[model samples]
Target: MERKLAAILAADIAGYSALMEVDEAGTFQRVRAGHQELLEPEIQKHNGRIFKLMGDGLLAEFGSVVDAVECAAALQRGMAERNAIGSESNPLQIRIGINFGEVIVEGEDRYGEGVNIAARLQALADPGGICVSGKVGKEVGSKLAFAFEPMGDQRLKNITEPIACYRVNFDRGSPDRVEPHLRNGYPTHKKTSIAVLPFSNMSGDPEQEYFSDGITEDIITDLSKISNLHVVARNTTFTYKGRPVKVQQVAQELGVTFLLEGSVRKVGARVRVTGQLVDGRDGSHLWAERYDRELTDIFAIQDEIAHAIIEQLKVRLLPDEKVAISATPTEDVEAYTYYLRGRQFLHMCSKSYMLLARRMFAKASEIDPDYARAHAGIALCDSVLHSWRYADVSIETILATSAKALELDPDLADAHAARGLGLQYGGQREQAAAEFKLALALDPDLHEANYFFARFFFEEGDFERAAELFEKATQVRSDDYRSAVLLTCVYLALGRRADMKRAGLLGLERAERELTLHPENSSPAQLGALALAYLGERDRAKEWAARTLAIDPDDLNAMYNIACAYLHMGEHEPALDLLEKVIPIASVHRFWWSTDPDLDPIRNHPRYKRLVERTTLASP
Candidate 1:
C-alpha cells in the first residue's frame, strides 16, 4: 500500500437503475458510448487516469487538483451536449465530484477519506452538475471561470468529520443567447437589447469632448440598470465614435434590436442634449427628446433620456431599478466633471495618461470627499500603473483606496471591481473572487471586471475559461485590442486552431483600427506584433515589434511583449536580447514570465534560465 496526495474524481450516472429497468440493453450501450466517446477521452486529455470503473460509475486520479476539476467540468459539459441531441427519453446524465487530499493507493485502486468525500459529494450533486470539496474550490477560486455556490459543511455518509463543499456552476459553458457567429441583425434572446452610440460633441470645443462622452456613458449606465433591458457595454459602442455608421449596420454588428443616437452641447452655464431611439429592424424612430437646461440639470437630462427609452420600450422597472436608474454618483457637478475627465484617459495604456488620469480623479475626490466613483477611479489607476510596470504602487495603497471607495458607496460596481483587482494583486484569492462576482452581479456589462477577471484566469493557466471571459470582454469592448490579442494567445494555448486564427486576425484588425485613430500610440503595435506572430506573419510581426520600440525605446512593457512575440516567431536571439534588457527593470512581472505560454518555446534555454536567476536577484 502507498499513500499519496492525489486529486480524486468520482462520477456516477444519474437514475441509472431507472434507465436500466426501462431498456437494459439500450442503457448499457449508451453508457458504453459515453465512456468511449466522452469520459475516457476527456480524462486522458486532462492527464487523469481512470483507476477503477463500475457498471454506472468510475473513479479517476489526477496529479493536479486543477486538472481534476477541469475534467469534471468537461465531463458534465460533454454529457449536456450529448443529451441535447439525444432522442432517448432517458438520456444519460453524469454527476461528478472532485477532491484533493491524501489517498491510500493499493495497486491501481485508490481509497481513503479523499475517495469517500468525493463519492459523497457526487451523490450531493444535482444531475449533470459537479460538486467539489472546499479545498478544491479554494484552490480554483480565482483560477477557473466556473462559479462555485457554497454548500456549507456536509456530513459524509461514512466519514468521521464534516467537510465543506461547493457546487460548480458549469452551465455557463457557452453563451445561452444567439451565438455570435449565427447572429443575423436581430435580438433573439427574448430580451429588449439596445446600443447607445457615443454622443456627438456639438459644443464646438474639442476640449469639451469628455463632457459629451460622460453624458453618453451616464445615460448608458442609467438604462443598463433596468433588468428587462440588455444594454451594449460602453466600450463596444464607443468603437463607433467619430465613425459614420448606419443604424441597422450598427445593430447587426452589436446584435441589438434598438440604437440610441445622441449629441451634447455645453457652453458655460447652459447645456443642451438631444437623443433619439431608433428601431434597428427598420430604422424607424421610436422616441426622440431634447432638453436645454442649466448645466446643474445635466443629471436630470440623463434621467429623462433613460425614462423615455424605457417608456418607449414598455419595460417594467421595479422600485429598486427605478431608484438605481435615477440615482446620481455625485451631487457636485465639478467633481463629476473631473471624474469624467479622469475616465477619458482610463484606457489609454500609457503611463503619462494614467498619471494625468490619477490627478484628475484625485482632484474630483478632493472636490467631493464622498465621491465613491472618483476614489474607485484613483484605485483603478494605481492598479493599472502597478500592473503595467509604469510606477511603483504598494499593494497596501491599492487596497486602502479601493476600500475607501467601497466604504463610501457599498453598492458601487466600479468600487467592487477596483477592490477585486487590488485583492487579486495582494494574493487574497477568495476575497478577490467574491468581489469580482459581486461587481459582475451588480453590473454585468462592466468591462473592467470582466477584463481583470479574465486576466486572473489567464495568469492561472486556465485557458478555456480565460478565453470565455476574454470573449465576453471583447464583446463588451470591441475596441480593446489587448483583450482581443490575449484571446488569440489563449486559443493558441488551448489548441483551438481555427479560433486562434480568427482571434489573431480580429486582434490585428482592432489594433490597426486603433492605430489609425491614434497614430502616436505604441501599445497597439506592441500587441499587434503578437497577433501577427501567432498568425504566422513573421515579417509583419517583426516590423510591428520594431515600430513599438521606435515609438518608445524605454517602454518596458512593450519590450517584454515584443520579446514574447519574437520568441513565438522563432527569433530566439533577438528575444533573448530583449529579455536581457528587460528582466532587471521588469522583475515585478517574474510570475507572468514564468507562466506565460508565449515564453514556453525558450523557457528551458540556458539564457532564459539565467534570466530567471537574474530576476530573483533583482526583486525588491
Candidate 2:
C-alpha cells in the first residue's frame, strides 16, 4: 500500500458473455492463453503492471501516460489481428480506457478516482479500440498514428466534473467500407397528404412557445383522425418549429401533398390565430384564415381550423372520425394550460422532467376534476417513467390513474394507450391488445398507440406486421427516437441487415441529438449503442454502451441491449453470457430468445437452449 501519481489502463473483453456461450471452455482457454502469451508480454514490454483482475477485465498501471496510451493501442491492434482468423466460437476483442492521475496505494492494492475514471473510460471503448481522458489524449496526441474523435464532455456517474473524452478511431487505418443507403422507396400517396408545421409564436414572448406548440399538436392530432388524409406526426413537424422554410421544401421533405403554416399571437384575454394551407405542387395557398377569439373559445377556433383543412383537402371522414376530431380536450382553459405544461415536461422523458410533469398534471386535475386528458397525461408520465426505470411508481398507480381518465372520458385515446401499457406489463396481453386497438380506433394518429401495438406484433413474432406499424409510427413522427430504435430491432429480427443498419443509424442520430438536451436519460444512450452495433460502428457502439452502464449499472433494459451489441458484433458466446445477466432481471426478454433473428446464429448452441428454458421457467 502506497500513494503516487501514475497512468492507469483499464481493459475488458468485448462480448465476453456471447463468446463464452459459443465455446465456454475454448473461449476461456483462448482468453487465458492470450493473457499469458500476449497481454502479459505486451504490458511488460511497456513497463506496466497488471496489478488487479476485476471479473473479465484487467487493471494496469504505467508510470508514463505515453507508455499507457501506446500499450493500449498496440494491444488493440494485436487483438484485432489475432481475431482476423478467429471463428464464431472464439473471437477475441477488448475495449480499453485510460486515465492519468494520482493513485492511493494500500499494501498491494491501488485505489482512487483515477483508477475509477480509467475503468469507466474503458467501458466506453469499442472492441479493438481505446478511450482516454483529456490528460492522456493531450500527452499522447502528437505521438500516435491514430486520430481521436472528441466525444464532448461526458457526464460520468459519481464523477463531480464532466470528463472530456476521446475515442481512438479504430477504422482510421482499416480498409475502406461502404455504408448502405438509408432511404426506403416509400410511395407518395395518390390522395392528399399534409404536414402541419409548428405554429409560430408571435406572442412576442419566447416563453409562449408552449401555447403555440400546443395549438400545433392539437391540429395535428385532429387532422390525423381523418382516415383517408395522410398527416405527418407532430414530432416530425415540430422539428421545423422556428425554421423559415418554403412551402415546397416542406412538402418535399415530408413527402406531403400540402403544407399547413400558421402563427399564434396571444395577448391578454384575446388571441389571434392565422393559418394557410399551401398546395405542395405549386406552393400556392389553397386556403387562408384568421381567427380573433376570446381565450374561452380556443376549442372552437381549433375545431374550425381542423374542419377547414379537411374541406380544402377534400377528404371524407366517417362519423366517428369526425366526432373524434371535434372532441374537446378540456373545457377549462386553466386546466388546459396546466395540461399543456405537463405535456411539455412529459415529452422530455427524464426523472426530473417526469416529476415536473406530475406536478403540472396534478394541478390540472385539481383545477378541473373532469379533465380526462390531464389525468391521461399524468398516467402516461408515470407509466413511461416506470418503464424506462426513471421512477419507482407502481403498475397499480399507472392503472389507477389511467382508469380514472377513462372513467372521465371513455374515448380518450391517450388514456387507453396508458391503460394498454399497464395491462401489457402486468401480463394481460390480450386485454392490452384490445385496449391498444380501441385507442387507435379512437385516434389513429396517436403515437403511443401505434408504437405500443407495433411492439405487440414484434413480440408476437409477426415481424412483417411489426415493421409495417413501426414504419407507420416513423411516418407519423420522423423524429420519434423510440420508434426509430424499436424499428431497428424489428428489421434485425427480419434478417434485413441493410434495413437494420439504416434504421439503426437514423435512430442513433436522433437519439444522440436528444441526449445532448437530456443527458440524464439512459434509454437513448443504451438504445443508441445497440443501433451503432447494428450499423457496425463498433467504436461509437462501445462508447455509448459504456455510457449507459455508467448511468445505471442495473438497468436491465440497457443490459439487455449490451447482449444485442455482442450479437451484432458476431461474438456468440459472450452475447449469450450477456443474456444470462439480463434474464434474471427481465425474464420476459426471453420471449425473443428463440425467435429473434439477431440471436439466430446461437440458437442451436446447447448453452443458449438451456438458458432460454431457465428464463422461461423463471419468468412467470
Q: For each candidate in the order shown, give its overall lDDT on alpha carbons.
A: 0.81, 0.76
Model 2 whole-model lDDT (C-alpha atoms) = 0.76
| Residue 489 alpha-carbon offset, candidate 1, angstroms | 2.2
lDDT of 1 by residue, 142-231 (tens): 556555544435545456676766667664544332112113325343347788999999999877988998888888888877767777
Candidate 2 residue lDDT tens string, 1-620: 57798899999987676566668898888889889877889999999999998557899999988788778878988887788867644578888999999899876667999998998787666567788887776566455554444443554435678686766644435422111110121113434667888899999987577889898988987887776776666656766766779877666545457888899999988999999999877788999999999987888999999999989878888999978887876788888888888877776554556779988998999999889988888887776666555557888888999999999989889999989988887778889989998998887667778888887878777775677567656646545677777777787777776667667766888899878866877767877887788787888888888898787677666677777776776777766777777665446655433455666577688977787787777673
Off by over 4 Å in 2: 1-195, 201-210, 220-243, 248-260, 264-327, 344-360, 382-397, 550-556, 570-585, 592-620
Q: Per-residue lDDT for 351 in model 2? A: 51
* Model 2 / residue 178 / CA error / Å: 47
Query: Residue 465 in model 2: shift from native, Å?
Result: 1.5
Candidate 2: residue 225 lDDT (0-100):
76
- Cα error, residue 26 of model 2, in Å, equals 50
